[model samples]
Target: MATGLLALLDDIAGIAKVAAASLDDAAGQAARAGGKAVGVVIDDTAVTPRYVTGFSPSREVPIVWKIALGSLRNKLHFLLPGALLLSLFAPWAITPLLMLGGAYLCFEGAEKVAEAIRPHHTEVQASAAPARDPQALEDEKVRSAVKTDFILSAEIMALTLATVAESPFATQVFVLAVVGIGITLFVYGIVALIVKADDAGLALAREPRPASTLLGLRAAPAGAPTGGDRALGPVTQAFGRALVRGMPVLLRGLGILGTAAMIWVGGGIIVHGLESYGLGAIGHTIEHAAEAAGAWLPVLSGAASWLVTAALSGVLGLALGAALIPLAHYVVTPVLRSLKA
Candidate 1:
């Protein structure tokens, strides 16, 4: 009886250790995935707040909630299964597909840059831009954001899968689930905080604690509006003002950076793919030369790879995107026009 009980205890202890190891793995993967998508996460957060900008106060949070739910759905429902299938049967296709998505990201980013440099008749955005009706606009924004999220999520999952290429199928699934849920929570939670920050600032400005209009403060009520909230308190007020003012600029920057990353990352993928198919000599030559030059400091080899690959990739993507742009404009554009027509 004692022997059987001890065996049972040993099994339980082993299972506990396995569960702990799994959790640790999941946490590590989440951190790595988060680091990988920092650029997209910034872009996502920056792009999202604008969707709630023109809405009424009461509707802002609700719309944010809707978009957050859509983001969750994107990661969990659609992307999860699709990514698993790709991993299983079409793993080889992942990089090319990612490159395609990356190209689209570059286009979107470049378009935004063009918009900024060009004219703006009104603060109003494009014609197909979001609506004002809370419900309608919420639905539209969620749909658009989810579409965007799917691309980013695919990248995240693909990267994670690559990292865990040799793991068991069940481990891959569990890690993916953890990554999806963790990233969704992190991204959307930050988005929520960002969207509500202005309101929070306004409230803090109005309900000035102990330190009132003494050092030149503005007072009202808790959660009340203060037009002078821009320059309310001394230090905190200045910080808030700066943050609020910088939001638009940061968004534009994020857009630009995201596009650039897309091009660089996409170009790298295509270049790597080319090498995989046959043209490996080019990559081999570069890598070998880099390693030789930096042989004294082996640590810098990884940096060398990143620099060589990223630079080559960006150049390649730009040339490719530019080459395709005209054809896209003349042929694809007209076909799209006719289809919509």
Candidate 2:
């Protein structure tokens, strides 16, 4: 009986070791995969803050939390499983699907540019509607945000899966789950912080006391020395005021940058896909240009090459996206609306 019990304990220890190792491997792979999807991640982060815009301060954090939950649901419950199934039975289809997603991103980015250049009357009318229940409006915004997140999350998951395609099936699943959960937490945490920053700044600016007082400053006996004893309060208040003033500009800049990133990433993906499928003319021409630039300025070679490639890709993405805009607005939207009806 003693020997049998010892054998059982030994087996348990072995299984624990294996489980630990698998988790470590999964974590390593998750980080690597997440790195590969950083471009999409930036776009995700950039795109999210806009959803909370014009919302009441009290509603912002809750809205972000709901959207974050939706994003996680999209990734874990939908995209991850779908990605796994695709990798398992139809690996060959992954590239084409990814290219399609890239095209969609390009379309979205270009549409935003066009919208900015020529604001839509329909959107203006929609915004002008008589006041509705705030909660209902909030829910609509959450749904819109989630729908956008689903597309971005799908791209992130597909990129991650492609990065880990050679791993065992179980490892692939584990790695994807880790990346999904980690990214959702990271992205939403940042969003929450960003959305609340103005409120935080307002509080800080309005409160005359130094931040140290909030952390249990010792009471000064007979007014020997207090928060007003130093310049910290005024300085902090000034900083807070600056933050309050700067946040809107910062958010706008982020929105613009995100849209540009979407176009750049989408363009790069399409170009790379073309190169992979034997239509390498564009890529080769870009490479040759980059090399020539490098030879002329050896010190800036790498940076110049990257800049050339990125510039061409952005142009390509913009053109492709512009071409698709009419088709999407006229054909695709009508078809989708008809289907829904």
Instruction: Return the TM-score for each candidate structure.
Output: 0.73, 0.84
The collision pairs in model 2 are none
Per-residue alpha-carbon lDDT of model 1 for 1-341, expressed as tens digits?
A: 99999999999999999999987876676577566555566567666777777777787777778777877787778877887888899878776775565565455544544455684566755797754666776678768867777777777776666656566777778877887777777777877777777776555444433235433454444575355542444545555566667656766676677667766665655556567678877567656755664664577867776676666666667676666656777898999999998
Weakest ten-residue segment in model 1 by summed lDDT = 206-215
Q: Compose the digit string of candidate 2's lDDT tens values, residues 177-240.
A: 9899999999999888888989988988986666666556744335544646456678768878
lDDT (0 to 1) per candidate: 0.67, 0.86
Clashing pairs in 1: none
Residue 249 error for model 2, in Å?
1.6
